[model samples]
Target: MEGQATLNRRNFIRLSALTGGGLVLGFNYFLSSCTTEQGSGQAFDLNAFVRIDTNGKVTIMSPNPEIGQGVKTSLPMLVAEELDVDWKNVQVEQAGLDTEKYSRQVAGGSGSVRESWESFRQVGATARQMLINAAAAAWAVSPGECTTENGMVVHKTNGKKMSYGKLVESASTLEVPKDVKVKSEGSFRLIGQRIPNIDNHAIVTGQYKYGIDTKREGMLYATIIRPPAFGMTLESFDDSEAKKSAGVSQVLRIENKIAVLGRSTWEVMQAAKKIKAQWKDDGTLESSADMTQKLHELLAKAPKDKPRRKDGNIAQAFASAAKVVELDFDAPFLAHNTMEPMNFFAHVKADGAELHGPIQLPERARKRIAELLKLPEEKISVMMTRMGGGFGRRLMTDFVEEAALVSREAGNIPVNVIWSREDDMTGGFYRPMYSYKYKAAIDKDNKLIAWHHHSAGVGGSASPDSFPAGAVAHYQVDTHSYETPVSTAPWRGPTHNYIAFSEQSFMDEIAHQTGKDPVALRLELLEQAKNNPAGKVNYEPDRFAAVIRKAAEISGWGKPKAANIFQGFAAHFSFASYVAQVAEVEKQADGKVKLKKMYCVVDCGTVVNPSGAETQVEGSIIDGIGHAMYAELTLTKGKPDQTNFHAYRMIRMSEAPEVEIHFIDSKAAPTGLGEPALPPAGAALANAVFAASGVRLKNQPFIKSGLFA
Candidate 1:
């Protein structure tokens, strides 16, 4: 099987005239040359990203999947902003997986906007310039004399005007320009504005096509009965009863799981429950308790450590300190718990394979499916559906691969494999449980002198460049990890999710022990990092301090607010963005923490869409706070104890607090918004809980530690 084809500017873009008197701009990033040959006869390329009909209707292909981060709307805004087109006249179409045409279609790391900002603008500007040049040639005037506005090319001196559709034929004949200017940020009409999601109407009117809503001719529904625990394999199964159930068509064993296929999803789900399966444990499995104990043991042994960063002499500084504060923090494994469970549709045949699903990485999935089916990469096609939620879980292609395997086993029939909530919740690839041991020293002058951090987990080391690293004179970071059979993958902010909680909470403790304000302490350290830095700092200290000050000012930090309300603040930088959050909490008579409000300040460079950026920050804060307050996945003999919402507690609407978000105003290139806001939220909420209850909750999932009780 051939690997993914390389993409370059020569083959990445093409322009051609449409048969119906319009223009088609083909942009190739993922598809191979063979795939392009399929549409050779047509005037327009088969994978044309932009199509303008004779009637002046414009269609723009959105390359990335819409995973609820509003890429479908935000990305197109970039194109339309540069294309000089009205949003109402433009329609967005979701593009299929094509690595050669769309180089970075995968939607994770909050990079959709950050990565697409320049390329998408170029795509739009290139198209617009073609139209303007075509209009200039027809008018026998210089292209400089023509200006475009709202899909119309106009002559400034005269009243001559031409619709983009009318100039398409001429534009198609002109050579593709080597250089085209994009609009200045100050002149952007759509990029910085608050644009409603293009699919809002379809979503509200129940016309959106999510993966679960996918259907095809002769498609069979399937549900697999997987192992109840990790390190366990299928030993035997009796599917006779399932085969006899109503609507049951076939019961097949694929790999280590049994698949029950039927004519309907409900029937297949019902029949799947009746199939009795037995599994044998590998005997190497351990419970979450054992894993936690193992981490503690590793910390105690002071195993051979990999030093991530070292500065000055930590031992000497600690010995000379007037006061030393040390603390240990632990966070348990967590499940993604996406609103929509894992699902995919696949049809495998002798000639080729087709897959449609909500996935984060389609190009990677296409390659994996090709390898699994023993077919060439070009022989497979992958389509993306609007995802309900990903949160990094969809980055894994296991579910999509399963659908393909099941379809092949079902004699090349189209199969849709839908995972129950239990299947998704109990599935592996969870956020690894992590433990952090932090020690800080202060001089007799009440100045922070030394900082040391040791982290151990199943996956790998936590981020070592966490804040205060470059603020202290003697700072050292060490990591120790142990391998486990259990799988782990990125969850939102990944390492920052847990590290922020531990590090920021420890900072709060330091502030209390030194009789200093928590927010002020962080600001002072940031100032130190800016002026007299200890070691190399990856983040911009100025921007870091800006967000901290902004958050404090906006949240009324150190000011008297409503009675009984306490505020806590925390900040962190990740993914090239700086985020700071202030959480407001109130303690009730029942000893439970009631989150009242949250204030967030973000410095993600340029803001593409103000409303969308605000929404993302707000959503991230809620997600982070909810997980910190009451979400954890513990393993019992390597089997997830939390299977459903009943066991895995989620923050309800009534418990959700009012979130106020503000973004730093700047013209710098935009960074990502999805993951950066999350890291600080957990720390801010944890700090707030401490302020309100006068009890420091060292462990995560505050509910698990009886912090509320």
Candidate 2:
């Protein structure tokens, strides 16, 4: 439970000072930290920020690129928390490219909340503290008595109040205070309160600008025609007709593909349609069927366990079992499918390059652009725009590099290269598909004896990286990997996403056979984990049991419910947060699933923005259910099979279940809300479906199971 906690006020002040003008925002605490900047004593630079004039118009410098994860508002809330200001008065802006003003901005792993929580807090708190100090000096009273509220300091004795804007000049002159006091948990007024998303207005009104909306002076639009498969190379291109298309300016090949540039994105699309480019498939084809077989093989041939934690002999216990049952579960590959597709505006001049895009990691994008241009990182600038959505896809900077290359080829006249929906779907990079085989043993009394679980995943499809792998004992882990034509990277919940389905479903089977309550059955396993567990360093049994029991009670388990709906339950600990989900669903007479309701309970320590955290948890659970119910990617001859929305499906508003989230308000430091709630919802739904029907559905997309039953 203890590691390096989030940065504090002192650290934030130091980092802000180095970055020139510091940025401050309140992000929910959920960003995964496996790849966070993990060094000390290195001061950051702050040239990319601009705090508003003292008119109470605070323009926050946004560091992490947001693609609909609500960072535009959520992140700024953190700053407002320490600044002692109301959330309404704050105005926010996207941070431009500058290492001096930011740290690593990679946005994957759902670490956005926890990763930037303290640093940004310090920025807001430091500035506000200084402002209060300035106000105190002006009032000639101790700051202790002059409380700040909604950007104004009130000298209660004198009944005089002044806005933070009135003290900016004086506050800016103050030296950075070391270790400024942060608000205690009980004192938080805005942090744990419900506030609408900061960008909600812009988004609803269409005023919000994403990377796809970016335009520069004399900017040209580009759509690239890369090889159909990953690792495939471009062999040749005949652009005679493409150059003749209306508004087409140039056709150039860069980074193993031909880019068609034109005066408009539409023109570029038209021109690209005309280009007849020949590609030689350098990568081998990997159909879903082929990959599925390879996945099973890998699961069966797993190697020695990594064993981050251990408890007892899993093999010995299973060998002595009075009953044993085995099952396999599969999770398919997925896409980020951000509303704003991959696009970046880059103006590569003889001296430098200016890049603008919706990206997760600005540092990575900057570095990648620098390398491609053969220029120094300092010479390349990245301007992050508000993302339409992230979902861990925009974290890759390859799109940025592609934009830079196209801009360079266009003679550095600011050019924005955009991917069509088809391009995004077939281009490359996907959530790795995964498979899990679970076997459980029980005694004559129907008490569980032992369990053996393993995975078959390629690339990034493994358990949540934060879950200590060596924590389990009597565990065996082996991976079977074959080269895939598609690229792979992290998705929401990463590996924990799939493992939850398999493990929770298998656990449900145990409860069903023994006539024990499902939630109680899991508590029993947590009890075993408490005594002689499978891993040495797995989760604390008490905490795991706490979430399960809490979820059951909060969900009104064993209580009466509406007609035609059955409840299923599951619990998981991920992203440093514990979550339990109970899904209420109905199988319609026509065979379509109606997800009537979902009840989610989460314990993420101190609740930061209760509203924001709840929203995140709700959305994540929906995404998990959506993926399990319907979402898949396939390939043929190394070409992506699904080209757009028609083939690749997502949970629509019509199909989205009604979600109610309950947060366990713990005094412990807050964890993340982005991904922990996602893992169990799928498994919970699966268990619920089985409860309704006599048949046990073992596959994902229960619809896939419907065919057999």
Best by lDDT: 1
The sequence of per-residue lDDT tens digits that candidate 2 reaches over residues 1-709 is 1222343333333222224343232221221222223135443332334354445666666667676566666777777787777666767676665554456565666666667766666556656677778788888888877778887888878878998666765664456565656677788877778778777887799897778888877988889998877657888888999888899999998868888988998988988887787877664756787788888877777445564223357678687878887888777778778777888888999989888878877888887877878998888877778777777778787788888888877787888889998888888578887777776667788877555666667564444222222333344443444566578777777778777777788878978878899987777666666775444444666776787788888778999876666889888888777888898878677654567889888888777677777778888988998888888887766678888999888888887888888887687766777788998888888888887775666776666665212
Residue-level lDDT tens digits of model 1 in 401-430: 999999999999999999999999997479
What's the lDDT for residue 250 in model 2? 91
Clashes of each: 11, 61
Residue 264 in candidate 1 has what lDDT?
90
lDDT of 1 at 397: 93
Write down the RMSD of candidate 2 (Cα, Å): 5.6
lDDT to native, each model: 0.85, 0.72
* Candidate 2 Cα deviation (angstroms), residue 481: 2.4
